[model samples]
Target: MTTTARRGRPRGEGTDARILEAAHELLLERGYDGYSIDEVAQRAGVAKTTLYRRWPTKDHLIVAVVAKIQDDVPVTDTGNIRHDLVTYLEAIVAGLDRMRRVGRGREPGDRSAGLVAEIVAAAARHPDVGQAVRAVFARRNALPLALLESARARGDLNPDARPDVIFDELAGAVYYRLLITGEPFGGDYASRLVDQVLAGARTPSPRAERS
Candidate 1:
C-alpha cells in the first residue's frame, strides 16, 4: 500500500498565526538578544520543522511578527488629506512606541529605541533579513502612498507634491527623532508633523494656482 505524505502548511490550519503570536510574545519578553526561535516553535505548539519551513531564520520570524502587528493599524482615507494623514500617522506613532518599548524594563524617563534598534541592527547584519525587511516595508507602505496619490488626484495637494518624497519626509522625521535625537513622539507631535509636511505639500505654486 502506498500513502502520500502531507502537503504544504497543512489544510486550514492557524499555524502561521500561532507561530507569529508566540514569536510576538517571546520578542516582547526577551527582546532580540534573548529571543529564541526554538522556544518560539515550542510555545506555538508547532514542530520545529514547521516553524523553520515558514520563517527559516530568527530575523525572518521577527520581521514577520512586526509585519503582522503593522497590519492591525488601519489607514482610512476620509477625503481630508491633512486630517486623514494626521490620524494615520498618530496610529503609526503608537505602534512605533510599542516597538520602542519592547523588551525594555520600566525606567524613569527611558528614551532608548530598544527593540526598534535591534530590528534595524538585525537587518543590517544579515543580507537575507535585510531583503525581507525591505519587502515587508514596501508592501506595508503602499496604503499611505496610495492615499497621497489620491490626495494629489483630488487637487488637495500640490501637483508637484511627490508621494514617495512626502512619505519619506514624514517617516524620516519620526524615525530621526527616535533613532537620533531621542525626542518624544508624544503630545502634539503627530499633528505638528502632519501640519509641517502639509505646509509644503498642500499649496500649489503661484503659476499652478493661476492655471
Candidate 2:
C-alpha cells in the first residue's frame, strides 16, 4: 500500500541560508554545549517555530552547519591528480584545523579537537545525527573519488589501485589524528600524504614520478 504525500509551504532559500549562517557563527563562538536554538532564531531573525520546522533539534542544526562547511570546500580537477589531491587534502586539513580551534582559547600547539570532538560525540550518540554526518562526508568525498577514478582511467594510476582505499588512507590519517591521536596536520603533511598515496597507487610514468 502506498501512502499519500503531504504537501506544505516550501521553505525559502534565503531564510534557510540565514539560519544556517547564524548557527555556524554560534557554533564557532559557543561550541555545541553553549549553542542555543533561541539565540540562533534571534540571530537569524526567524521565529522559533519556523526554525524548529526546518531543524527539529539543535543537533540537526549543527549537522546542517557541518554539511554547509563541507560544501564550501572546493574540489578541483586540473588533470594533475597529485596536485589536485594535494590541494583538496590541504583544504580539508585547513578546515579540520579551524574546526579544532572553535570555541577554544588554546595556543597554536593545542591538541584538543574542540568543537570537532563535540560533533563526533553528538553524531555517535544519535543515530540520525550519525547518518547525517556520514552522508555529508560521502557527498563531499565523492568528488575526490571521481578524481581518482578519472586518473586511473587516464593511465596516470596503477590498474590495480582502488580509489576508495587510497582516499581512506589519505583522509583517514587526518581524521585519526584529529579524533584519536590529537596530532596536528598541516599543508605540508597533506602534501607528503598525497605523495605517499600517489607513489604507491600511481603508475610508474615519468609524469607520475615528477609529482
Q: Which ten residues in a row have the lowest lDDT in candidate 2?
A: 1-10
Estimate every model's Cα lDDT from 0 to 1: 0.80, 0.83
- Return the top candidate by TM-score: 1
lDDT of 2 by residue, 1-211 (tens): 0112212656778989999878876766776667689999999998887888779899789788888878877898999998999889888899888877755366777787766777787788778888989888898899999999999999999888889999999999988999899977754998999998899896553554575
What is the alpha-carbon lDDT of model 1 when measured against the actual structure? Answer: 0.80
Kindly give the stretch of ten consecutive residues in candidate 1 with the minimal lDDT sum. 1-10
Query: Which candidate gets the maximum lDDT versus the true structure?
Result: 2
Model 1: per-residue Cα lDDT over 1-211, one tens digit each: 0112335426234878888878876766676668789999899887887778678889889888768867877888899888888888888888888766655374756787766676677778778778888888889889899999999999988998899999999888988888878788777898998999989998775565674
